[model samples]
Target: MDRHNVELNRERPLATPTDLASDAVRDIGAGLNGLLADVFALYLKTKNFHWHMSGPHFRDYHLLLDEHGSQIFEMTDEIAERGRKLGATSLRSIGHISRLQRILDNDSDFVSPEDMLSELRDDNKQLVAILRQLHEMTSSYNDHATTSVIENWIDEAERRSWFLFEMTRRSL
Candidate 1:
């Protein structure tokens, strides 16, 4: 079924219980939606960079972007599922994702490999910050499942950021 159909047929109060209050689940789901949007945006940007990447490091940059894009895309499903598990309707469409996303898009015809790497690194760092903020929220709510997922996400985002930093680094 489509998102609209799913929206019209949502399971209220959640089928499963985790002891979290309904309000808490709703609040956490809202936050996860934002993360979902950001992850989607970053995924697209990473794929765009993968497609447009060119220069001396063409092969290496292309492969790196592809890998990072895959990782980012992977998060979208988990984030959305988490929201659903929390008794939320979750994301509706690309428009919905676009509305919640914070990552700045680059529509330039050509962005240098280094710039692509740098932009993605910054975006990933922003995601890490978002995850950390959500981590605090989850902790407060005693949402250990959400906290566990966010911790893994933070590690992945940090790794992505670290890789980008290393690739763009210039020794003195």
Candidate 2:
């Protein structure tokens, strides 16, 4: 490897100052970055289950996972762009995502259909709580732009959770 630009990273400040204090921008951006990473992880896991899912309800389960995964993936771009708008360089790679992500990754081992639905439901529920926490932080810092974006994300996440939970109640 060339091993160049090493010093650039060390010297790069988190974000350019805006209406919000530099500290506040950095803080809010960091929170968004973490949220973005978790959402990305969750999206991947949801897709994985979608692909690997088996059993009598395969079509319904697959479609549900696919839809939810798309929603989660959609959130990542907005979150990352918001971070960039704040001048923060968001996540750079999958390794970075993994480092900041809150969602757990599942291996290839077989999981029962119900187990998959339950796991995703719980994960989405956890994600909603995280979004609320970030929203509060953004509110406290008067980062209304971030807060506004978070509200929509929370709604999407909650919807995903609702769908997952509903999947659990009706069929095996």
Candidate 3:
């Protein structure tokens, strides 16, 4: 291929045709990629807590975290694919995810079970908020498909947060 063609190919790899305008593609792709990064971060953190879980509630908390981790991990592929379907490039590396992720990692040597549950609950709440924002943005751009998926994600995140909240509740 000629240099100009090569440059064009380099700019857009695996591009998919979409009705959305370039601005819509860029904006929605950015939102989806950032959401994907947060989902991956949350997934790893959930797994970390699950692996490190201990105490009288070990079995319950461990199982819960494992389930949550799986759910969070499941969102990554859909988010990335949605971005690609919008004719934009998806996240290409760990560094890209790290740069875009809003969710903070828990790197403590040890975190108490209660602290782990509480932290995860808060993170899920934050994820729900992010999903809501993305839903609004996508809807405004007339991207009904993306907004529809975000609605489901928002529900899932809220459910996870509710579960964590109940687990961490202290009877008085």
Candidate 4:
């Protein structure tokens, strides 16, 4: 192969064969990778809060965060695999994830339990919006499998948000 051909090949490795067209693969892959990055960021933040939890609600808040963290982490593998199945390369490293992730990180030395729950609730709502957008795009391409998976994720995110919201709310 000529130098130009060699460089092109290196940059765009042969994609795994799939029914998705090149455009669909490109668009969906990019979307999935971005979502995956956000998921990782959120998972870590959830864990951080869980570890740092204190005060009267320590046990309850810690356990809630642990459960939320696990649920967030569970989506990472499926998201990456789905991208690969669509013939698109997924996130390769922490640096790559940092570059693509939209979710903000919390690095404070101390975040109150209420604040942690509130932030996570907002983040989960943000995730639901992203999932909804991806679902619409995937459906437009007739990618029913990806859309179905996203639907379940959307429901899960909403539930997480609901729990977080309730935890932070004042008793009436």
Q: lDDT of model 3 at residue 30?
A: 91
- The sequence of per-residue lDDT tens digits that candidate 4 reaches over residues 20-87 is 88899999999999999999999999999999999998998899899999999999999999999888
Candidate 1 lDDT tens digits, 14-105 = 44445789888878988999998889889999999999888888998899889888888988889989877777668899999989888878
TM-score of each: 0.89, 0.88, 0.92, 0.91
Considering only N, C-alpha and C atoms within 3 Å, which residue pairs clash in candidate 1?
A: none
| lDDT at 147, model 1 | 97
Off by over 4 Å in 1: 1-18
In order, what lDDT does every prediction score?
0.87, 0.86, 0.92, 0.92
The C-alpha stretches of model 2 lying farther than 4 A from their native spots are 1-17, 170-172
Clashing pairs in 3: none
Predicted model with the maximum TM-score: 3
Q: Looking at model 4, report the run of 10 residues with the lowest lDDT sum.
A: 8-17
How many clashes in candidate 4? 0
Q: Write the per-residue lDDT of candidate 2 for residues 41-152, one digit (tens) a residue.
A: 8999999899999999999889988888888888888898898887777899999998999989989589888999998999999999999999999999998889998899
Question: Candidate 3 residues 1-172, lDDT tens each?
Answer: 7897677678876666688998999999999989999999999999999999999999999998999999999898899988988888889999998999999999999999999999999999999999999999999999999999999999999999999999888821
